[model samples]
Target chain A: MQLSARNQIRGKIKTITLGSIMAEVQVELPDGQQIVSAITRNSVETLQLHENDPVIVIIKSTEVMLGKQA
Target chain B: MQLSARNQIRGKIKTITLGSIMAEVQVELPDGQQIVSAITRNSVETLQLHENDPVIVIIKSTEVMLGKQA
Candidate 1:
């Protein structure tokens, strides 16, 4: 799917492998970039992600917001 | 200051420059890395970040969780 915003963070599914109770997910970005993140093994089986699947990476500005909330 | 987590994401305040209504936050990382993110100009002024200020980057596994949320 084409993104409306250029810098909007998103990921392309590369592969998923089981690792004990955790799943190692490899997500690719535009220009062949990739990052590996771990998640629940169940989530991986549930999602059933395959090679070349489009996925969104959602991040709230506040989440990245550094500072004490008062 | 020291980080307990080896890969804990954080930023070192490099500089903040005003740009229109936005503030360009230049954050540096270890090994001489950096990423520029834009925030409200007021936030910069409010935070009063100076050189070498430590800032945390919080990201939930669910947020980077690829696939649709159910």
Candidate 2:
């Protein structure tokens, strides 16, 4: 399936911290960049995510915001 | 105001394509990577964004997703 999200970076799961209804996943890029994602608990279970698993980070262009230094 | 978004990258606005109620912004990173953002026209006006303006790219963690190769 095709995704409309503009950002799709490849990374490895560094960690997954589960909460009541949410999960925070840390994805480490090959360039050493780190991105934290907070997704639904169900998504984690559905994806069967685990540490060191290769995954694509998905972010929609509409979800992006621009801020100038104040 | 502190934003809950986990990703905030530094870049400069490259272009702005305005529509009836929305606008698409292209930002170029220091490393020449580009990020596209689609936002409300009101937000563009509110922020008064312009080309060549230095900006921060903000994305909420909850808006992030992970996809594994099927």
Candidate 3:
């Protein structure tokens, strides 16, 4: 499927922390970098995400902040 | 500074498309993956973001979707 989102990172599920309504997912890239995402618990179940599963992290935000070092 | 956002990718600015209120910034990673971000024009000026600038992309979203191939 085509998405308007421009950032697409391929990573493996490293951990999953479930809450009452939200779930925190940690995705580890091949280069040893980890990306954490907070998603709805229902979407987590719908996606059937689990540890060691290969998945793509799709992020679309209206506020992508830029930071530079001084 | 510390941020609550989980995903942070280091990349260089490749392109910038500015509008009256919002702006589109394209960041290219080392692995050749491009991540696009939409930010307000005020932020663009505040951060002094421009092409070829090295910056970190910070994304915080409540809806980070996961997609798996069948």
Candidate 4:
């Protein structure tokens, strides 16, 4: 699913999914790191994502709901 | 804020920020719309975001904390 929008979140893909279509990534910064929780697989195919691939992660601030992992 | 990761979320930028560096976007899908709430500006510049630009939004499932907007 290709989208033409303007909200891009760029970061290094610290990790990829283990079994299912999922992965963990961290956004590098001059100060610190903004580690995000999940990255979907379908998105990978749509975005043609790969390891070490310079990619952008867009987040609607409102969509950024705070929670703790189990 | 440029990042080389593998988790890319693709979607359309429904709206941009009014005053502050903020915006609201909607991701199109085969079934329904996954209306996420917020998109940050720094992430935008990092990815060189522009209007109608195809971009990816990376979300750590853990980071996806569910909540209501006030």
Candidate 5:
């Protein structure tokens, strides 16, 4: 399936923290940089994700904000 | 103002294409890499953005998705 979201970063799941409704999944890149993602717990279950799993970080352009320095 | 977005990239506004309701904004980084953002025209007007303006690209964690390789 085609994705409209333009930004895609490859990384490995470093950790998964589940909350009541949301889940925080940390993805560590090969370069050692980490990104945190907060997704629905249901989506996490649907994805069957676990630590050390390879995944792509998908971010939609519509959700992106352009901020100017104040 | 404080932002909840976890991912922020420093860039400059490269272009802006406005539609009836939405607008596509292209931000160019120092190394010449570009990121595209689809934002509401209302936000574009609120920001008073123009080409070549310095801006930061913001992506929130909750909106981020993890895509597993098939």
Candidate 6:
């Protein structure tokens, strides 16, 4: 599927921690870079996400901040 | 600075498109994955972002969605 946000990285599910209303999903890339995403528990159940499952994390925000090293 | 968001990808600024109030910045990773971020012009100026500058794209949202291939 085509996403407008443009940042698409292939990662495997490393772990999933569920809370009452939200769930945290950790995705690990081939380079060992891990990206953690906090989403709704409903979405987690809807996506059927589990450990080692391949996923594409979709991030779209109007406030993508930039940082520089000092 | 420490951010609560977990998705921090190292990328270089590819391009910057300025609008009246918002700016669209394209960041390219080493693997050629391009991430497009729409932020405020004020932030773009505050961050002093420019083309070819190293940056960390910070994405924080309560709505990080997931997708799968059919």
Q: Positional deviation of A40 in candidate 1, in angstroms?
A: 0.8
Model 5 B-chain TM: 0.83
Candidate 3: segments with Cα more than 4 A from true spot: B61-63
Could you say which candidate leads in lDDT?
2
Model 1 accuracy (lDDT, Cα): 0.57
TM-score of each: 0.44, 0.82, 0.87, 0.37, 0.72, 0.87
lDDT of 5 by residue, A1-70 (tens): 7887786767899999999999999987655656789999998899999999999888888888888886
- Docking level of model 5: medium
TM-score of 4: 0.37
Q: Which ten contiguous residues of candidate 6 chain A have the minimum total lDDT? A: A61-70
Cα lDDT of model 6 by residue, A1-70, tens digit:
5777556667789999999999988887766767788888888898788999999877775646677776
lDDT by residue (A22-70, candidate 1, tens digit) is 8767776554545455678887778876677777654434333444223
lDDT of 2 by residue, A1-70 (tens): 9887787878899999999899999998765667799998898999899999999988889888888776
* Positional deviation of residue B21's Cα in model 3 after best superposition, in angstroms: 1.5
Place model 2 in a CAPRI quality band: medium
| Chain B TM-score, all predictions listed | 0.61, 0.85, 0.90, 0.45, 0.83, 0.90
TM-score of chain A of each: 0.61, 0.89, 0.91, 0.50, 0.85, 0.87
Q: In candidate 4, what are the lDDT values of residues A1-70, reduced to their tens digit?
A: 3322344555666555532666455555334566564655554555555566555666545555688999
Q: Distance from true position, residue A59, model 2, in Å?
A: 1.6
RMSD (Å) per prediction: 7.8, 2.2, 1.8, 9.2, 3.2, 1.9
Error of 6 at A10 (Å): 2.2
Candidate 4 — which residues are off by over 4 angstroms? A1-7, A65-70, B1-70
TM-score ranking, high to low = 6, 3, 2, 5, 1, 4
Clashing pairs in 3: none
lDDT of model 5 at residue A60?
Answer: 80
Deviation in Å, model 2, residue A30 alpha carbon: 4.1
Judged by whole-model lDDT over C-alpha atoms, candidate 2 comes out at: 0.87
For residue B1, what is the lDDT in candidate 1? 53
